[model samples]
Target: MRTRLFALAAVAATALSGMSACTDSDDGDGGAASGGGTRAGAGAGKVGVILPDTTTSQRWGTDDPKLLQAAFDAADVPVDIQNAQGDKAQFQRIADSMIAGGVKVLMIVNLDSATGKVVLDKAKAEGVRTIDYDRLTLNGGADYYVSFDNEQVGVLQGQGLVRCMGGGATAGAEPPMIADLNGSPTDNNASQFKEGYDSVLQPRYDSGEYLKGPDQSVEDWDNKEAGVVFREMWEQTNKNIDGVLAANDGLGNAAISILKKDGMNGKIPVTGQDATVQGLQNILAGDQCMTVYKPIKKEADAAADLAIRLYRGERPTTGDRVKDPESGAYVPAVLLDPLPIAKKDINLVIKDGFVEKKAVCAGRFAPLCRDAGIK
Candidate 1:
């Protein structure tokens, strides 16, 4: 599972200076609100944020709101952050509540483009500034966008698979059979991720260096559904699948579980994103190859920076812009780079405080963590 991808560790330079994971208390009304009492002036209304869901990734439930709250609290700007819990109706209701409550700025990690566009359009009609956080709303036409180089995240997965498969097809051996366990089709980031990994893998498939196996997308990035999907692919492939390009940690773990059931876990290389504790443990145990780490603190900071500026009624300028592939409109953006993590690079993530060392090295993983110099 070793590779030269350790060079990508430089992206950690923008990591959080100091912060540990903590439990965020609820605001009693089914959301988390931070900052002081309402301030008097033109742009003093609280900033409203709507997160996508908590089940798909831990970041939505634990990391994002806390980081965003800290950012707003530091600037003394009131904010209301809420998770939609993966419901489109709840997403709309949350947006309606924020807008009707006179929020000056609304930021969101949209559940989907159609749902987001409705909310963004409503906010725009009400003179509230909007920002697309992490996942861009396709035709939503958000004023600004903040996220990492998501396509690059997929590129890393493809490259990681190649490295774990012992490089390209050998002269006397058959080309490795690769399976793609993609993210939800409805997510724009999912499409971008597939585009990225395909850029790296399609070439090999064409050159006879690799054989493409079952390619499928998990519905809503559900872990249980992902397990079912991977199991089906395993049966369809007659367990001949050699490697997996799983879009994120959840999907990757799903495939790894299926492989483990057949005692083929370590034999088949698997790639993941999000660098969750489970994913890191899998890397430690040799069940998975690598995961992409997109520093959430950096993303939350960048989005909050933009929201703070908007809340102050100050025009924000960003050097980067991302065009909405569906609308052909360019959005002001603050894009960060994503880092690829292998077993050897797990220490970098721990050192960055994204995942606590204790959480990653718990119980059975303690020895493996030490062997990898994670102390």
Candidate 2:
């Protein structure tokens, strides 16, 4: 497993280096140059990207890197991308290496928020600008944070589950029982998602319109752990679970798998985030209810642009300010909105080219794909 992971990293590094060298002659601003005008910041310093993990979702391997690389290439900035594969020690080592290699800007999707805070502190001390990508690194001094409106993401999850419970007006009488499986405890986004979801669900729960079972926070957002946790919840609840509020697609899928084993497939509604291929398939298959669609291209582009601006000693524009939990300092942040996707809007995700139809429709899902008009 270690060898395969390292090999994948090597391939990614080589690919990035090749692309960087090819685009080195252009200016780093990502703007087209006039006929005889010199490119802006031509041969600018390197930009290092430290991604969290690939095991959790397919987006890390496909959408994230592709979009980020395109944005960086257009900006003409060289990039060095690495995946930590959910290893905190490996994440630290990767950050250290990037800093030592004289990277001017560093972007990271931290696997562990506490450890990430330490890494960000080191980057700040070394004068390297840091952009917290997707997941915020709490208590860490981050120059900029780029992500979706996380609270809204949770609200969507809550609302979707409520909808899945059937008529909102009669939800009180039915009072579907649900299990809440949140993401990694260390990630600040997890809390933000919980806030949004709870804000919606708590009202229903308090009004006796819905019954919530055991709510568990999965460590590292591990699907296997989520499966085990959910299985235990199933047994504890005597298999009376009617709905599930899973933090993301990976965990939702894990929960769904366990539900299927218990012969509860398509009977309960499950919520998810990050409109991953599997999540979308599950939606079409009637196993999962909905997923929050956060366009990776928009996010990756924004982060790259902000990182470049910071590298040039410019403050990027951001609409929101988030206080650092540890430092008590407010930082500029760009918070985008999230879209909830169901089987009906699967075409929208496809129209946006977030996922290829073939990728989602392959294997057993092919027939379902055609039925859903995925072509």
Candidate 3:
């Protein structure tokens, strides 16, 4: 399969005579960076990467930054990658330091729209080109935006939930009462995800094929809070809530934990995204229905490519742009397709290097993995 990050290969600038690719093979010319932007090299400017809290997903801290750093390592450019840890104030402080340290490019997965605007504005005033990574900054504006086709992510999640609920057009059947534990209200991707799933669910709801239950966005994709909130919603309705429309793997796991307590794990349909280790394990063990897999390597690579171009004083080009709802600006974007992973589709991620065969097939999961033809 063609790597999704290869979409902008042609637009990769060839001006770096001293650059190197991340791999020795034909992985394309846009891979290398210096030991540090401070090191004596041809591309001497650092790129700033500010990821939102690690509580929401492990990828932001453990996986994504490493991928981006590897690509930067190949390009001989330096990067300052840091995590905001869900604190808006910390996010601003980190951005301020990056800008003051003379980073040429700034990429962020914002904690919320309010503080994001402040950081992005500061970066712009300092002549730092900004790229909205994973989450858009709304009206804050940026040089580019890169992420998965989040709406499609919701479509997959919604469809998965419906299937798990035994959805059909049979007349007079009452649809399941589903709880929507969406992501943080501060993030734009959360809203886009809702838009995607709502496209599928609202129609079903309108036709009386699905019943809307308690629907609320988590404050910061807080799993602990998700558990508390969902439990209250479900218990308040006398445990009549039939299933869940969880926004991501974290929330799904949160709800699954609650379901396990009530002996409802895998008994009712639940949907998720991000395909985290916990989410996949839940799927293999028959505790969760599915999780959408958005390859972090592809996303980080694309963001790194854009950042490299910006740091090199090259005008990066992208034909596709995502509309900023608040500003009405069509910010250039490279939105990749997300894969829906069920019990059957586990091998695709393993084969594509998105997950470890060892991680998926270890110990208790061995039999389940073998049963799924993972071996």
Best by TM-score: 1
Instruction: Go through the candidates in order and give the clash count of each.
Output: 0, 3, 12
What's the TM-score of each model vs. the native?
0.89, 0.86, 0.88
Given candidate 2, what's the lDDT at residue 316?
A: 39
Please list the residue runs of candidate 1 whose C-alpha ends up more than 4 Å from where it truly belongs after superposition.
1-41
Q: List the residue pairs that clash in candidate 1.
A: none
Q: Write the per-residue lDDT of candidate 2 for residues 1-375, one digit (tens) a residue.
A: 000111111122221222211142434422111221222232446889999888888888778888888888887778898999888999999999987777777899999778798787777666676788988787776777777778889999999988987843363365678799999888888998999999998888887778878899999889999999999999999898888999999999999999889788888999999999999999999999999998777778677876666555444345455666667766666666689999988999988889989889989999998898876
The digit string of per-residue lDDT tens for model 3 on 147-170 reads: 878888988998898888887346
**Which has the better TM-score: candidate 1, or candidate 2?**
1
Residue-pair clash count for candidate 2: 3
Over 116-227, each residue of candidate 1 has an lDDT whose tens digit, in order, gives 9999888877777788999889988888877887888888889999999997678998888999999998899999899899999999999999999999999889999999
Over the full model, what C-alpha lDDT does candidate 3 score relative to the true structure? 0.79
> On a 0 to 1 TM-score scale, where does candidate 2 land against the true structure?
0.86
